[model samples]
Target: MSAYPSHPRATIGRYRNRGAYDFQAIHSVVNAAPVLHLSFIPSETDPFPTIIPLLGQMGSFANPDADPSSEPLDLYIHTHASTRLVKLVASQTEDGEKGLPVCASAALVDGYVLALTPFNHSCNYRSAVLHGYATPVTDEAERLYAMELITNGLIPERWGNSRVPPTKTELQTTGILKVTIESASGKVRAAGAANDKQDLENEGVIGKVWTGVVPLWQTLGEPVSNEHNRVPVPAYLDNWRKEANERGEEYAVETARKKY
Candidate 1:
């Protein structure tokens, strides 16, 4: 197992020591995030970048069960066929998944650090950025694989719990973007506030300001079934909710530690 070699663009500049090139660390950050922000230029003539909130998972369909640390992985994004991004992808004629160049970013904010001074304030967080080339998947088998991968990634056994397979009409409207990840990196800030010694010594500032962390967490609400639905919530779903909340709780605890 090896880390993805750092690319010039993927290199972290600020807080350089915090940069993490480990594939597992980077992949876990991306997978744990609730939503991925996908950014890309719509066209060469377009001046502004287009950004969209997306749901994605990284894996190799050839060996989907393999640990992400072992080798290269691709990011699969589920989308609709008529989306603007999809239109641009279909318009492209490049080879080798030559659809569009994109950057995928994911982040988790554990807490806010209220420092003695505004300049010293920070947040406990984990973030990851991945650069890749995305192309619309045309293969039927790969499409199905991506669909199931996303479903199970968010909620284990969700695909089976729902309809076993999508209908032809459903598959026609659904689309997947396969991004071949070229470079990626993860950065994390878990320490507490780093207020300057001078600020700590200021009696006037200390008297008026309360400095500490307010922990934040992502929690799942109780499941609510639709009026027409009669099936009870599955055990796997309940377990997944507990696991997700526990992960958030662990990070909240991490942010509560004394500044390292």
Candidate 2:
């Protein structure tokens, strides 16, 4: 689907202009984020929902060749088989086919906007939230596909370079959660500080207070080898690190310069 249908739970109420329902917008933010926050009700008797940080990726195992920007995809999260979330999903799905309900979110702060007043200060960021059903993957082929996707998503080509196939115990202990998203939305703010007209007109305030955006991005540093390592940093990893740093800094700086 090109865009998710607008639902009350996923729609943005404030600053509606910043909200986007397109698949490209939502998927891009989620995939680029370093980690995702997953919120779910632990049990029927629990009054509060619990949130956990997890590494997740969005892709279609059935259609590996599909384009994420235009095609539908599933969210995959890897964890230990005995984790509470995995066990909970297993128990909930035992009676029926539907899995446990969950909400997943991802965010990236592009820059910090400093305004004259603290109330006016804001951040330039991209965020996405999704509502879905989560279930543990059972099929061996699909599980393998998701494992490879998750591993490579962290570091491209590392899966093949380090290992050929997982050991029996390793495979048995690893758990993969497949989330079929029902509703999703993305919101973004990519502009410099928005100062009030009165503040801008006052020389004392304008001259004294520095109002601008401080660009921020995650930088990949030089790779350090562990003890007993025999090989130098491979060309693939070195090249990826250099290019990623450059692209990240460029995007952050460009976003900081944008005017509201």
In lDDT terms, how accurate is model 2? Answer: 0.91
Ten consecutive residues with minimal summed lDDT in candidate 1? 90-99
Q: Which candidate is the best by TM-score?
A: 2
Regions more than 4 Å wrong, model 2: none
lDDT of each: 0.85, 0.91
**Residue 174 error for model 1, in Å?**
0.7
TM-score for every candidate vs. truth? Answer: 0.94, 0.97
Among residues 3 or more apart in sequence or in different chains, the pairs in candidate 2 whose N, CA or C atoms overlap within 3 Å are none
Model 2 C-alpha lDDT per residue in residues 92-134, reported as the tens digit of each score: 7896968999999999998999999999899989999999999
Report the error of model 2 at residue 197, Å. 0.7
Q: What's the C-alpha lDDT at position 192 in model 2?
A: 88
lDDT score for residue 132 of model 2: 92
lDDT of 1: 0.85
Compose the digit string of candidate 1's lDDT tens values, residues 15-126. 9887888888788888788799999998788799989998988877887787887666789998998999888877773544466889999998898888989888888888
